[model samples]
Target: MSSPIQRVRTCRDRGSPMMTGRTPRMVAVLGVLACAGCVDRRFIIESNVPNAQVYIDDQPVGAAPSHSSFEYYGNYTVTLVQPGYETLTKRVHVRAPWYAYPPFDFAAEVLWPFHIKDTRRYYFELHEATKTRTDDLLNSAEALRLRGQTLPAPERPALPKVKPGAAPIQPVAPDAQPFPQPGSGGILPPPRQDNPLPDVVPRVGP
Candidate 1:
């Protein structure tokens, strides 16, 4: 039977050194380290306005001149807000590096000699706020309303009415008698008893 030392020598002679227990562990560790270099990259964000607040996907990152890391290679929404300045939004696209894509990615993850890092920078200019024209718009609307009020209303024609049952009467007479006036003296007064009773008494005595 071969001893332990003799067995080790036989393994080397057969060119199977990787079959050793410790060598497999070492290779696994080295593979893990090599693949770690292909991790996502860091992106730098900056703006002309100093100390502006920054947000990514509605999550606050930091003020301007900030640093952020992403694990994706797609579109991202970035927002910048500052006092007395208009808020701004940006759509950032993080494309994978040429080496980190397709068949070449295999070389970058395993065959590349050094750790590869992808760093990107973005810059933006913030604009100042402007005066609002809401009052001017309201004034223009009021002027239009007053001009409408000054215009004459359109006249509508009167509609004729029809009764259910009505006779065709004669025409009115032109020479109809008129009512008497109060100050024209046309009304006479009743007679008084001044001489009527005296004449009746004389006839009775005869």
Candidate 2:
């Protein structure tokens, strides 16, 4: 026969283990639902020339030593321009960190307990543009002019003129003579001795 206090105390003792066992699970669930970890990614672009304008994918970002947030990891086109410096253009590849890769990315992005920052840095050097000398340009132009003067001019054959709606004139050989017209009464030239004409007069009254 247990007293009333003893029975109450025994019940409490039995319930304490259940409450104790559920505390850690409740805490873990609250933690998981309270806040999720996040990943911040950005890139820093720098150049040897100070104040050089920077462009990413043809969109202007700012000057050298500039930075911008990015969402993807891949190839990017970068262009730099400044006064008295040759314009520079190049392709940059942003590689993912070990934690940023598959399986691990899920943990780092959503399940991790802390925020993660991923930064990539890039640097470029620029060279001064070459200056052209007036004397050198003049010398090159003079050499070209002299070469042109020394070369012989090309000769082209003259074309004969034709009247509109008229038949085109045929070309004649240099040694060919014009045929005499029947009404012009012009006599035919004698045959050459090298190619005599055959004599075949028909017999009379036969």
Candidate 3:
């Protein structure tokens, strides 16, 4: 009986020292480091899309970690990509100045068939030449010295000012026939005579 009691006491004594102590010094030390252990971690966000790449400020940030949440703070460029869809590049911000960081919780909702092939033939030189002509017309002041550029125009053409609440001009319908303008030298037609016939007009009329 004495041996069993001795064995139980020895087992209790052999338990972890971390669980055994309740000293003032021990409690103070635990309190100081507890913040590191209990700090709320932010999630590194990622979506399961094929061939997805991430970019920030036109620079790539490799593939996102599939495990745990993304805990980055500050502005970010979030992009999700699949072969069939257009490379969706969106500007995202995950900033929280207070505390370690806020919890990361964001998910991408995938959709299908977002873009068509860039098959439209485009020429940059043609566009550049056209732009040069347009800019030359709009930017005539560039031909002068810096100080002389802002001089008042020699001739100021009078242009009609559009009034507020003006009626909108609409295009004529393609199938519509043009009618003679009312009150413009055309004879004034009589008012439409009300039908004197019965409510149910006879199919065989005399």
Candidate 4:
């Protein structure tokens, strides 16, 4: 008879206010929150020597043996730097929650292509770009499509060879006459032709 009474009380207890309360409801709500969300992130930076500097896209991140992190879902650069070793960089892809990977040393990004620009304005400038020269204003895509004359080959004159112990050559005249040499004793007589001898005297043939 006592066991029957106890069972009845237990049955009535199911409908009681204390029997159905907020304890179970709170547990279930917390469980759902813990399971569904983005991961967390932690970044560790280090160097062989202590107190190395760090940077991101020319912006300073922190010092070496330093910790930096991001919570949002995106991409960020991790840069670790020391004096002696080359600059080391790591690209961290943070997805959802932040805490995904263990702490580690990392580095920033590297150099990109440089463009030479003319600062002055040309005859026309559609925009504020410093492409001052003719080629300066043109972009990669337009410059390729431009058709113009090919540049002429450069003319290279032949170099003159110098002779050993030789005086520099001078231009000579075509009808130049040789001058008489000083200190020469000869007054050269004019030669007479065979027929001209008759003008002086008629000669008898031997």
Candidate 5:
């Protein structure tokens, strides 16, 4: 009979192949359980003017030379405002990388076991706000006034042309009678004259 220690060693050697076969499966299961994919995306905004306020999609983010994280890729409206500088507005399109698209994204975002970082940077320059001088403004006003004066006045509608030999219109006096007298082609009858009654005799009463 073989020694018990030697028998145990032989059995372990015979089973080593089975252990080896299961090792890869165990590793794969552990990887699926513990590993995950991630994507980190951010953008940096900078301006020629330091400390300029930054606005993204009309919402204020912070001062320029700053950064913020984003989740999706597309057009972004960027605006920068600063004292004594003209406000800067622009549209920025962030294009996705190959790994961020469709089927590739699935692998990069779910199956890949490492974090992927995507970074974008933007820069803008601001122009100084132009100041208007009082003298120049006054000059412009004066020039406009002169030009207006030179323009011909709109001609009054020409009075209706009077035909030749047409009767001239006579102005009526304020106190003139508006109606004609009787027998002067007027419709009203002549006024009636009043007759006086003979003096009544007081002694006639019986």
Candidate 6:
């Protein structure tokens, strides 16, 4: 038989307190409570072009008036497509909320009792596609050419042939002498003080 004191010690050891008995449940509840503030941010994208397909970062999200969610803030590419309209592309900048910053984010992730959500709306304008008049002008020009109504090529007068300019004659110096003929003796005749030939010669023809 056990002693009275020993029996009392055993009974006390067997009796579990509420704190130990509910430890797991209390932890789970605390975890759920701490995560309550974790939330996603959302934004709306709208365009004036009705029924235009919307795309974000090349992924088709929805049509105009689309609602999107993001976990963090950053830039995104938006594209709009519609029939008989110019495709529109633009860059969208989304800024982080106050709670997403360092110190605030810590509280928002762990301590806040409820989720905080941020929503923003954006609108865009799309322009219609325009037709170029170049093709019409070209077609008209080609039809005029085939009908021989085009302007005739103007006749160009023949340009006169320009003779090469004769080389300029150089002036003879007083002391310079003429070159001797090849057949004549190399020595030059002595200079005469006066003319030896007759001044006038009778002509045979009248």
Lowest lDDT block of 10, candidate 5: 188-197
Estimate the Cα RMSD of every predicted model relative to the unseen true structure. 20.0, 12.9, 25.4, 24.5, 15.0, 14.5
Model 1 alpha-carbon drift over 4 Å, by segment: 1-32, 110-113, 134-206
Task: Write the residue-wise lDDT of candidate 2 on 54-169 in tens digits.
Answer: 99999998999999888988999999999999999999988888987899988887778787888888999999988768878998999999999999999999988889999998
What lDDT does model 5 reach? 0.87
Enumerate residue pairs that collide in model 1. Answer: none
lDDT of 1: 0.81
Arranged by TM-score with the best first, the candidates are: 6, 1, 5, 2, 4, 3
Task: Report clash pairs, candidate 2.
Answer: none
User: Backbone clashes in each candidate structure, one number apiece?
Assistant: 0, 0, 5, 19, 0, 0
Candidate 4 lowest-lDDT run of ten: 104-113
Decide which is better by TM-score, 4 or 5.
5
Residue pairs with backbone atoms closer than 3 Å in model 6 (clashes): none
Q: Estimate each model's TM-score.
A: 0.52, 0.51, 0.25, 0.28, 0.51, 0.58
Candidate 3's displacement at residue 1, Å, is: 49
> Per-residue lDDT for 109-143 in model 5, tens only?
77787788899999999999887688789999999
Stronger candidate by TM-score (2 vs 6): 6
Model 3 Cα lDDT, one tens digit per residue, 85-146: 45666666655544333232211111111221111111111011134477886677666665
State which candidate has the highest lDDT: 2
Candidate 3 segments exceeding 4 Å error: 1-28, 35-40, 44-72, 97-206
lDDT of candidate 4 over 145-169, digit per residue (tens)? 5533344567999978879999978
